[model samples]
Target: MNDRRIPGPLRRRPAAASLAAVALVALAATACSGKAEEEGGGGGGADGVATDIGVSDSTITLGALTDMTGPYATLGASVTQAQQLWADQTNDAGGICGRDVELVVRDHGYDAEQAVSAYSETSSQVLAYSQFIGSAYVNTVRERIDGQDQVLVLPQAWSADLLGSEYIQMVGSTYDLETINAIDFLAEEFGLGEGDTLGHVYFEGAYGENALAGSRHAAEELGLSVAEQRIAPTDEDMTAQVRALAGDGVDAIVVSAGPRQAASVAGVAAAAGLEVPIIGNNSAFAPQLLDTGAGPALLANYYVASPALPIGAEEGTPAELSAAYAEAYPDDQLDNGVAAGYSAISLLGQALEAACEAEDLTREGVAQAMLAMTEADNGFGIAHDFSDPAAPSSTESYILRPDADTPGGLTVLGDPFTSPLTDSYTRE
Candidate 1:
């Protein structure tokens, strides 16, 4: 892992060290607002009331628990910037329901313990968590979030455990559903036939397991064979795994890991003369990989299944939004994380707006509003419907292939694709 932190304006304060000062400042500001709004009292509708800790007549604070100094630091930095952009835009538009959206960001370094500590310190001071960056961190805090009635927007959609959670909402299709869609694309686009063998390289956690589950199901339905390899998030080399899969004569590889791991797999496979196609889940692909030795390898054989369009697709909501973001922050590189951050805030904004309109701005109110959302315009050429708790938030994914000319080193291959497995997959 890189020891250097994210540079420039993107770096954020460590969660544990900065929580006290941030809370004190927020409280002081709130105190002044309370004095002014005392006469007006709560600001909600006739039937709904705003008695939440983070809610005030003029402001609503949101917490962001992110990994600014860990394996995902680059992504975290992009997400934070996108989130700030969303808040700034909303505030410029007169804010959400007349209350300015104030996002308090914290760096948890992708550690579960750090995340818990950050949550403990900041949970009471915010209306809801605008972003929680890791599946493990979320799992660690799941019980507490439920027990305390906290509402949050999860950064990843790979965990089946998050299904139907009252406090946690996701913005994309689950890892399982995404893998199924990827399989469908491969089968159709590449002329994969019965008895074709597919290799899967994945992290050894919920995200990977869920993706594997989806691949397994799809393989069964499609009459394909699966060869599986489990890698840890911290694993640096995937040479052995790739070699074994290649030795097994797998026709293609499906990766459910991160950028580094993805790069390793592609590089090693190329080095070992395995030229089969490699497909990855959303998180497995990153623009940074293009700068590595694996760049050519990836361009030659890599594809990614994304819940949203690529960052700089020529046409779509994502393209327009990315253009606006570039105009706003020219220094930042447009990537999937930035789009993801924007999507999260967009969804949260919808819920907040709905809650405000209903005169219920409490955490529960926000959750209810989110669940009631029938159609969420992702502003990125994707559609998400959260009305059905049993269904994945998104059941479709766009396939992307590497492109040197694109900002994210990728371009959408075709229209968003869906599979029947997604509709029938049971959420656990």
Candidate 2:
């Protein structure tokens, strides 16, 4: 791994073994917070590290506001479990700064009200949020997360609207950038240029809108017309949308919704004889879709754009994580969520260790430590730079296609690339 330390203030600290022992002995249980045991102790412990909320003498509590029993329930469960696996590994390795890392997880069920309530319930107890899923839901709590609590959050969803916040750190490329790269790939592969129309099927929210923004930008740059079809997250059937796009004589289609929506669109398009190359954002496809009736259609024409390598890949971090996850979760299947979730916590852990070395484990200190990381690479196929808050960590995206025989049901179709148009485009 790259040396994540960024020349912060340093001091001689206690041994990891000794610190773990001390923290274990000094650790006490908290009653109100579901998973947060520490209520933020002031002053230094046996070690002279500065502490604040969510950090007791012995433990550092982090939060995960996730979706369960909702649209992304499968991904949510896998991501939460991956985070738990990282926590276990960190604690087993003697913890960070002699403190055991504790994760406080809550399922929001992808409901707006429930998401806010979950955050309100656990905001005071966590030093930062390791996993905050859902783009629109996270937008609702942006003010509180950055202004009121001043906590660093690594959200699972990537929306351009979430950019330019010191407290909210996105790990990979945003939806707009990913979409731009996807459009570039499609144009390269299918000779789509001036006068051609590209169909966009997206959800009616931040995630979908941001991706739509990318498609629009690409359309302008390539002189292609855009056929827009906006649908709600609850709208899974794509028969109408696909028929409309086909009637418009679109050269291609971009699906920025869920895996179910992607499947429906591909199936409906094939059945309708649309016969166009279909593109999707990272979150649009799941491995399980291969077993459905739409599987052949998806494999025949569909391609996906992603900021990270698929968990099914046989090299780098994905390979190692796949083996460990398979061992840790024998009953569960592998997915991209596992890699994404592990990467988020791993990046946060990097910041925590940097803060500990700087002798400032407070929220502000940790935030600064993360900001100091100009080149953050966790072996996730992208070398992310967190220096610019307004820009995405990385603009490069992997172009992948679904395969029934692949380990994670997706295979790398080509080398990762970034669109030149992305440089001229501005993020809001």
Q: Identify the candidate with maximal lDDT.
A: 2
User: How many steric clashes does model 2 contain?
Assistant: 0
Output candidate 2 Cα RMSD: 9.4
- Estimate the TM-score of every prediction: 0.86, 0.90
> Candidate 1, residues 86-175: lDDT per residue as tens digits?
899899999988778998899988765677667766766777887887776666556556654455555544555566565777777778
> Candidate 1, overall lDDT?
0.76
lDDT of each: 0.76, 0.82
Per-model clash counts, in order, read 1, 0
Model 1 stretches with alpha carbons more than 4 Å out: 1-49, 423-428
Off by over 4 Å in 2: 1-39
What RMSD, rounded to one decimal, does every model reach? 9.5, 9.4
- Candidate 2 TM-score, C-alpha based: 0.90
